[model samples]
Target: MVRPVTPASAGFRARGALVAVAALVLLAGCSADGEADAGASASPSSSVSAAPSSRPDPDAPLDANQACAAMYVDGGKTLEERIGTALVGASDGLDGTSADQMHAMAMELGRLEPRVPEEFQGPLEKIRVPFLQLQEALDLADGGQVELDIASTVAGLKEYEKLC
Candidate 1:
């Protein structure tokens, strides 16, 4: 007679399988050597050094506005993660309300989305709403609203991962 696995055991096996697959995928898509990965820019003038000889160099460091577009061309890598990290970085200096911080974060995230996956184009579209709410929260300091905004951001992030 064959023994059957329980639900708990099966779930563990499934989780292990997922981890293995993710690892393989990551390994398969390693970024080119000697160049800064899409999310990690070189320095203040990183754009200038990276521009094609035919294209004019950007005057700024990382153009938050152009960030998403870069992500789109980066082969649909960790666009969501890069966006989230960039937002958190922008929010770091703020002492204002959640709305203010999240608004800033969302703007920065928007700048970064063009570089993300094609699938993320629409889901990220909805993120603007929560971001606006976040700005309002900054004025009101609604901690509850802050939590909601983060939840929405995370939800959008989950969509990005699937695109990869």
Candidate 2:
């Protein structure tokens, strides 16, 4: 006879499912041709460009307006758009690929932090923290922490949105 599921058993099953999904996401990132999908980085609201003008000044400090301009450079995905794209992969739940995307984005923002106005640094850190935690959870394979990380990410995003 089939037995009714207990809370502990249900939690175990959920964790197992999360692991399976993470594995699938990792595998799907690779193709038979050995090239990642180009569209993977494209956001609905922005396009990727390799032009020199599309790049931000790596060494120069920027005022708030300049920092916002750098952050929203045309032909490159805006921060909001990038986050949205990453979240699309996390619609059902957080997976390795999504976590990696967010972590990379956070790293990119960190690189820009030194060049940004002091007023913007705190909000940028707020955005980066949850993304970092999300990746950490994935790295540790802590399925239970993924939900909390995702929630934190969304909250952080909301706070950062008030800035630019």
lDDT of 2 by residue, 1-164 (tens): 11111113232123333343334334332221122122222332253445635754568887654555554443355554565455444444444565567678778778877887777777667556545655565567644524323333444444443454
Q: What residue runs in model 2 are displaced by over 4 Å at the alpha carbon? A: 1-56, 147-164
- Model 1 lDDT vs. the true structure? 0.41
Model 1 poorest ten-residue lDDT run? 1-10
Q: What is the C-alpha RMSD of each candidate to the true structure, in Å?
A: 12.7, 12.2
lDDT of 2: 0.48
Task: Score each candidate by Cα lDDT.
Answer: 0.41, 0.48
| TM-score list, all predictions | 0.38, 0.53
